[model samples]
Target chain A: MAKNKTFEEKMKELEEKVTLLESGEVGLEESIGIITRAAAIIKELEKELDDTEGKLKLLDLKTDEITPLSEDEA
Target chain B: METYSVSQITKKISCLISADTTLSGVAIEGEVSNCTLHSSGHLYFSLKDEKAKINCIMFSRDVRNIDFLPEAGMHIIAYGRVMLYEKTSTCQLQATVLISSGMGILHEKYNRLLKQLEAQGYFDKEVKKPLPTYIKKVAVITSPTGAVIHDIINTIRRRNPTVQIILCPAAVQGSAASGELAERIARINRHNLADVIILARGGGSLEELWPFNEKELADAVYASTLPVISAVGHETDFTISDFVADVRAATPTAAAELVSFPLEHYLAHLSAQRLRIAQATTLRIEAYRQRLKVLKRPAALTQMLAKNITGHRSNLTTLRKQLAKTAETMLIMHRMQLANLQIRLEANDVSSTLAKGYALVKIKDKLLQNKEQAALHEPIDVIFDTFRLKAEIVEIKGETYGEKQNI
Candidate 1:
């Protein structure tokens, strides 16, 4: 299991990495490393968003008593 | 008419006066009349009763010892020897001790003046103007050659050299000095050159300092729009001008010090304020520099763009997966429903019923739905998949029974 990064730390690292890349002063080698780190941060952020969406869906399912009709079936 | 020398006649008159003089100390009680405090500080008055009156005199030294003031119509006890005034050819009481009968005369005058001014609201703190902390230009209404002016100027120069002194030279004593002082005060106020006015005079006898106690000078000081500092006489001495002025200083030097600020202290305070501002500005700039360093990092840019792209791709993939899953679930459910419907349709099909070896019979044109509907002699037609038959039921034989069939 991946250790979850706090929301604040993830946001800060993401912001810093983006600023570094936009400056365009880093060497190509350094750029690749930074980009890889940025990709990993992006994946983490996506996982977080997915987890939040899943939680929201579960909440909706628990709250709603009426079953939703599929379009084709309707 | 004896042949007497000039010295002899004087000696004889002095001897006779001494013999008739009341040598013993006597206490005479009467109201004071024609009270006159001479320039020499001697008090001369008339002690009078309803029936008779006698001349009285108090030496300067004895008058000084008296606690209460002596004025006309004030009842007082006089203790002195009766002597003959050879120059005036009259007899008078040479008093060495005097005391008030009960109330003090000066106290009455003070209380009366207080009431009059209080009614006029002259003593109201609200109406009194605040003295200027730094009297840049001060008008001095005092004798130019007196020590009062010199003391004030020296004190002011010592405290603040920048303060300008305007001298309105006036007489500070004598009968005419009160009018002159009042005029000079009005003149200084008319010029409007000074922020504050100082009325000062050196210490002197009460009669000599009476000019400052005049009502005209007091009113002028009260009416002044500019604030006034009255410094007349010693600390123990007080006059009407002290009551009317905005502030009363005990001495001339004190009045000057009251209006002057120390330049070195003020400069130090200003320098401290400037240093505080400079330090605050430097701190603010350093904070901004730190924030700029934080914002200049290289990793922030790449992270932002990558996050956007990843978010879009992830959302697209999720939607695609959700669509596929939904489509698969719908397909499975439709297949199940189709199979169930097909079974129901086949069970209701007439050909399938005939294939199950069940025939439908009808009597005449009516199809037989029940055996009771067919009469025993009625002609019936049997329906099979390929052919039909007509038959008559001679006897129903109690309706044929078999295992119940499901369609």
Candidate 2:
């Protein structure tokens, strides 16, 4: 009900919507409606994924240096 | 003493022991020895501590409940009845329950501490903080140089390369371990840096793992604002830290997994979801198109009116495209819907998340998300986050689910 859904919650909601549409029980307009809502969820999920991927900064065990390690180095 | 038959004496002793409630349902704690599991599934063992020993018999019915065979040199608490066997005329315990406490005194201490903390509401679900929806940064508290840290890092890296870990090196054993662990946990909370905290160490014996059982670490865990995942020892060893932390992972690697979201797997899942939605829409459209095709097709109808509409057009074949378009226009749902699908079926290039998570309203190309705006079934360009879309206003309803999903 809330827009502040966690990544897990958003993914779960998307799965449920897809399942409902795939069941072939819902009407054409309803399927359209479901897909429209799913698009919004996908946008948020994709954005989150991008944000998560970019957060590659880490703290070393011996040093206090806050180094932004590249993908390979991290 | 009165002279009596052996059977009579044995029966009398049995009756005496049965009548005594304490002997009937007593729990005796000691080292187990001479253990034998009979072919019939019955367990025979002797419980001994220094000076004395007691013969114990756990029947097959009761032995069914036990998971492990009663091996010699295992310390356990046996619960059942103390009685005399009539045939042998020997006093022995008939045990129904056996709880393994391998390390004797240390095990007792662990149990005692566990109960005390549990009673104090240390392990209450209400007190436990929920792990973040997706953890971005995690603080790991473990030995700086060891397999524990490397194992955790590798597990996390393999699952999600993007997850960043802040190493809070602490002694995982000996007297200094508890203080160092407590200090590190406190420090992580103080900085408010990470989404979660992982308290971890490699597996060791009870004594070697004693630091995790100390009250000092528990005090910090209870006070920590950040969610704590305790992975102090192997799956078999559960310390006081495990009980106190928000979650108790079986191992350090498991703890890493709890914090790291599997990035590639979920991205693939999202892609699959998008494809499924598209497929469902395409299937529906195909079905409608099939139904339209089966209908007498506007060709015959248009041929009759072709002379009236296009006076010069002698060729109805060339004008069939216009006729079909006219028929599709009659079904307004098919027209705008096809256009809508065209927009959705395009490349999914989302550049940014909306300033507001999801807008309740949109006008022209810009989103007009506001508390004041009515939640109507109006289509908005929700794909390609920053990109604009063309949408038609439709009848709105309260959120049953989503109103303008597919369309």
Chain A TM-scores of all predicted models? 0.63, 0.66
- TM-score leader: 1
Q: lDDT winner among the candidates?
A: 2
* lDDT (10s digit) by residue, model 2, range B1-407: 78998788788888997899899889999888999889998899999999999999999999999876666766789998888787887778999998876666777888888989999999999999999877778888888677887888888878887677777778898889999899888877877868899999888877679899999999999999999999988899889999999999999989988988788877888899999988888998998898777566778667666668755464576678788888878778787887888767652221223433533235545555543353455555543345545565565444534555843
The window of 10 residues in a row where model 2 chain B has the poorest summed lDDT is B347-356
Give residue B140's error in model 2 in angstroms: 1.2
* Candidate 2 similarity to native, TM-score: 0.45
**Deviation in angstroms for B198 in model 2?**
1.5
Candidate 2 stretches greater than 4 Å from native: A1-74, B1-109, B124-133, B190-192, B205-207, B261-264, B287-407
Clashing pairs in 2: A32-B405, A32-B406, A32-B407, A33-B405, A33-B406, A35-B405, A35-B406, A36-B405, A36-B406, A37-B405
DockQ of all candidate complexes: 0.01, 0.25
The true-versus-predicted C-alpha distance at residue B255 of model 2, in Å, is 2.5
Alpha-carbon shift of residue B273 in model 2 (angstroms): 0.7
lDDT of 1 by residue, A9-59 (tens): 665676676666566566557766866776676566545433311110000
Q: What's the distance in Å from true for residue B25, model 1?
A: 10
